[model samples]
Target: MLKHTDIWRAIDRLAAQHGFSASGLARRAGLDPTTFNKSKRTTSDGKLRWPSTESISKVLDATGASLSEFVTLVGDGTGTNPLQRVPVIGYAQAGSAGYFDDAGFPAGSGWDELLFPSLGDPHAYALEISGDSMEPVYRDGDTIIVSPAAQIRRNDRVVVRTRGGEVMAKQLIRETATKIELLSINHAHPDRSIPLSDVAWMARIIWASQ
Candidate 1:
């Protein structure tokens, strides 16, 4: 039996693979941004609101993705397609309060998930880099896996959380008794220096897909 919920989930997955939000995909398809939004799936009366064929055709045209691709994206076998699955959250929302708990596990809202090919690390979580700020080293769409419990050392690629709840990924340069210096992968980005006391936690980067 074909499930509407399953199709909805597949739409989300396909959007992520193309590095787009559901709204973003809708706009590209010349439809309203809410076309694929979660709220639009079922109404208050419990009636399913399937996407229109016109909207679907528009999406196909905009994405240049074929019907077979759409089927593969939503098919039952898709999850087993040799990709290492990791919990993914957007970098922009990662720094917000409560996004991660005191123990560094993902917490309250403003996050979405995705699966990627597995790296050897078992404790990996993917963070989508948002801007060109990381540039040559990490592009805007690049997704990086960070292991919170992994051993962190000077000169390692790391994801750092500040006392103020900001999260950033950089190359550790020098760790002194009082402060830590981090090198930005992009020459255009300035290096950062933070007092040891202001760092909440630091995690090691296990893998990254640019």
Candidate 2:
């Protein structure tokens, strides 16, 4: 269960990590300066007040932080972890051979490294978006973090590799024993339904540096 204090503390730590005070974070998120003030955390009657989901969303977007990263902060509330160096590759290049292992985990050469907060997934890697196929949500040149270890569910944004060597990012629509359905991020692109046998591997996209 998520504790009220933990969530508030996470917000404070997130602000501090980005070199901002609580009020500054609120302002950066386009909220009133007092939105995250300590005094506002509780009512005059001492009733606990939780942050609104919209406020949290705005802060995350403003900070370029992932939901997973905020959840980690909720647990640790410590921004002490050192930046991690993770493998990175171009989205288009990911379709080429020798880049990923059979399970879709990054492998072989031609991968560069990037320093980012540890996402706690050993198989996590970054992909630089190349074309407008995923536009609006993930523009060209955006960096997206993918984790093969993360659990995939309906509607989760994911990176998928096919046995035929096609790699693409899309939202998972449905999956079953025989097929996987994907909804394109850009409406201009057509949604896809691939046989399970054609899918070499699929991984959930955990974060993106927009």
Candidate 3:
């Protein structure tokens, strides 16, 4: 006996547990930052504005929660609790070096941890994209889940880290002994190829809002 209200309640609880406002959760999931805002939950006519399936999937990935955990969160029937604050950084800023220490962890102030159902794996991060540079494929303000431990395969979407300490997300077109080819999602941008030696590290993109 599933109801739309139950889903909404689950989302609300997840947001609270992560110490994010409903809108904040929505933003982290790469949907419209206002999609889950309290004001947007109810329509102008006062009817409930349900969240979409796509949005739910993105939220799950962002929080590292399995679908089963989401169901329990929804059915817990307990009142929403406040979320614990953790450091959050935008996708553009996360690309820069020094933001993370030598151990590849977030550093410095203004950081807060987002709570999600335990997934056993501890190395996960959230990245928010900006601008239409990668549009039609990844829209502005979309949040992406990056797992550094995930294996990278050809044609997989990945976040590439260069020797210069820059990060860019693109599709891996091909890999050879000497170079790597990357395809840009936005047609406006041309594909790129670089020597394998220049690459520092790459993380596969498991999920994205767009």
Best by TM-score: 2
Scored by lDDT, model 2 comes in at 0.85
For candidate 3, write residues 1-210 as lDDT tens digits: 234566688899898989888888988988898777668677899987767658888999888887557756754366543232333468778768777664345667765445433322356566778888677767787777666667789999888777788778889999999998999988798888989898877777765544
Every model's TM-score: 0.55, 0.71, 0.57
Model 3 TM-score, 2 decimals: 0.57
Model 1 Cα lDDT, one tens digit per residue, 1-52: 2357656766777788888999999998899999998889989898987665
lDDT of 2 by residue, 114-160 (tens): 76555677778999999899988888887888989889999999999
User: What C-alpha lDDT values do all the predictions have?
Assistant: 0.74, 0.85, 0.72
Clashing pairs in 2: none
Order by lDDT, highest first: 2, 1, 3
Rate residue 24 of model 2 by lDDT: 98
Which regions of candidate 3 fall more than 4 Å away from where they truly are? 1-87, 101-110
Identify the superior model by TM-score, candidate 2 or candidate 3: 2
